[model samples]
Target chain A: MTVQKVWSLFDRSQLYECYECSKCSGSCPVTLAGDFLGPRKILLKCLQHGSGRVIRDPLLWYCTTCQVCQDRCPQEINIPELLTGLRNKAAKIGNIPERVKFTVEKIAKTGRSVLGFKVERERKRYNLPPVVEISKEEISKILAETGFFKDLKIDH
Target chain B: MALRYAFFPGCVIPAKYPHFESATRAIAKVLDMELVDLPFSCCPPTSNMKLVHYDSWLALAARNLCVAEEQELDILTTCTGCVSTLKEANYIMRQKPNRRRKINRILEKAGRHYEGTIEVFHLLDVLYDHIGLEAIEEKCIYDLNMKVASHYGCHLFRPSYIMYPEFLSPSHSYVPTSIDEITEVLGGEPVKYMRRFLCCGYPLGANVDEDASYEILREKLYYIKAAHAELIAVACASCFEQFELGQVMIKKKYKETYKLPTLYISQLIGLAMGIDNETLGLKEHIHKIKKLLPRLQERTGRMRATL
Candidate 1:
């Protein structure tokens, strides 16, 4: 894969247009809830420092990607997209949260988020049809081909 | 075009809240809307999974869309999160050819291609936009004259660029009113409350900080109670869990009481249409609908008799 392909993940030029305005922070649910730094500060960190610093911060995981900051950003900067890119890089370094790792691993291996037994019980209990089964072989191939397994260090 | 939709019941709903799935299907039958289930995986919730692997998220979402496109039918999602992820994916892949080519290149491994022929809608949108409020009014058998609060979860509204076009009107961009209109159509008064657009704190509450997440829910419940809301009607499964179960968690943790019953918008709609409570799974709600259903059933029986 070319460096350009990796760069495309974070290639939002609108991010550079940010003038340190706190409109994003003002509207951020995380910042308002006092759980995480607002989008403005995170973006500022990305501007002054590289994503390396931003990616490692445990606070990055707090963002629900609610998109309020991105919706309210005056500079048209796509903050959520940028945050996702940072998380991607973080995942590559194995800095992901355990809960997220569990979900991603389950999807990668089984092509669904939760275990099948629970769904089976629910299906039988509700008298609904069986849950649709995804072809795990195909999903694994797609994930491997897209370098997603490599990114998450999932064994193929 | 007899109102048929390829139903995308996202992962969580079937596993965690099967009652929601039951109620949605029962209500769809009442409205003469056909819900055909498709073999689809998760919408790959953007809350966390997408944050880690954008390419995987796009490819998975596009693959789901391809299934709906293969059926040559638009998707009708039961969860707000699924609609948001799938709708944004449709918008991006359809509009950007370069990105589409990139995703398709990966999708070829799964033997799927996303031509973007399908559109995505939350059940709320299908009720308000596709079915129309007037038709819903005519079908309504019960007058739920109680004051209800609309919890239009975060995914249904923000990221305006991707979802704004579907808003009721160009001027209605800032405030989406489909759920509110559906409330009135069902004969319930939609109560306005502070921070109506706030996140249910379910994603973060469940994922990152349990305490902070509960605090967010507590704050919303306080405001809803102050607004004199009898119940909180939510369009998202995650939000429903946050309010219904989160209320219990709040009581356990802080000894605070918020007896607000949270219902899926579909559950409430089914109730007003005189669908039996058992079929609608009204009894499955964590905060019991035991007290509220009689009032609705009594009114519905009287209305049907009069009609």
Candidate 2:
């Protein structure tokens, strides 16, 4: 991947406190789940070559973002969020995962999340949280559901 | 007194998030208050900012504050994230003129200059401040009798700039203040459920395994369900969205667990105002608060008979 101008402009010092802390690696549920996520490797990449190359790593997609790292970080590096920052930068440069694209498409085609239910779960329980569907007519006006349903390919 | 203030229901509630809008409007009307829509755009600080482009996130939040400022009313929002984003941006702009100028410069190209004048508040702040407990009592038609838990999402109260004076702690002691005062006025019991003030896992919107996105709420709901509260109340939109959307996901993922009902402060107040579930946008929800329906019907029936 070509070097992006944004990489050079970012505040490098903002995320510089992790002293090879493996606590975040120890705590991350995603890391435990056999995903390629751990704070030690992440901190090494970020420090050695700058975040530019780290942003392009496909393995960065495996974060569950439980923030167990933030919970347990002795150095308080917010490792998961740093990874999220890298992923976000990558996304701007065209790096969304295929599964995410699928979910987005499903939401676009349907009004709700991909987990759109046939039975209203709100009705299943005695307690309901305040949620309502977006009306179709209203949705058409804003290209409203499109961004959420990035998986779908309607012209609008 | 003539009751009128600028109303700024963000992108979600008015269209897709109608339940919140309907209930809020109902409660606003019963208080004899008028909410003038601020016609602002999204604060756009979430998935789009911090993670994506921090500058655009701040700029989007700034654009929203500018629109609300033009109206010169304390911008009252249904969404806590919007309120926090706008308020934080307003504070940022006030404290750092140089950064504000750069953000304003981007806005100027788009024909907007953010002056950092408008104050942003979540719906709870307005209900507590403008319509005091006494006012709510006067307008309340239903004594709900619900034992409620409160969810204060991080963006609303965390940074202290946007939170009420008393609730500044993460393990919030003042969890029950907003819902308690309103519930007490409406003749309900206020109960402290476990983890009453934790994040609702809403911040994980932009990820895969979105069901697992609810990993945080399991601990939260376990504590809440343990308290045996009849219902939960919230002051934040993303939290409410998380609770309502994640209830079934939480139940299924966590293995046959039950959760109490959830309500935004507006919906609860709407019940107090004699607004029916249909008009309050309850039909759109798959999560059922059927427990409160009969109580609400009885109140409506009594009011109609008296008339």
Best candidate per DockQ, number?
1
For A36-127, candidate 1 gives per-residue lDDT tens digits of 77688878887787676887788888876778776666666777778777777777887888888888878878777755467777666666
Query: What TM-score would every model get versus the actual structure?
Result: 0.93, 0.71
Model 1, B1-307: lDDT tens digits are 5699998889888888887888888778767788898888878888877877887888888988998999999999988789989988998898889889998988886788888677888898898888888877777788887789998888987677787664533433356788788888788899999988878788887566878787778888889989999888999888988898888888999899889888888888878877777767776777887777667533433343111
Model 2: residue B272 alpha-carbon error in angstroms: 2.3
Interface RMSD of each: 2.2, 8.2
Residue B60, model 1: Cα distance from true site in angstroms: 0.7
Candidate 1: Cα lDDT at B264: 89
lDDT (Cα) of model 1: 0.79
> Which stretches of candidate 1 lie above 4 Å from their native place?
A2-7, A10-12, A116-118, B166-173, B297-307
Window of ten residues with lowest summed lDDT in model 2 chain B: B298-307
Off by over 4 Å in 2: A1-54, A57-88, A96-156, B1-3, B161-176, B250-259, B294-307
Please give the C-alpha DockQ score of model 2. 0.12
lDDT of 2 at B57: 50
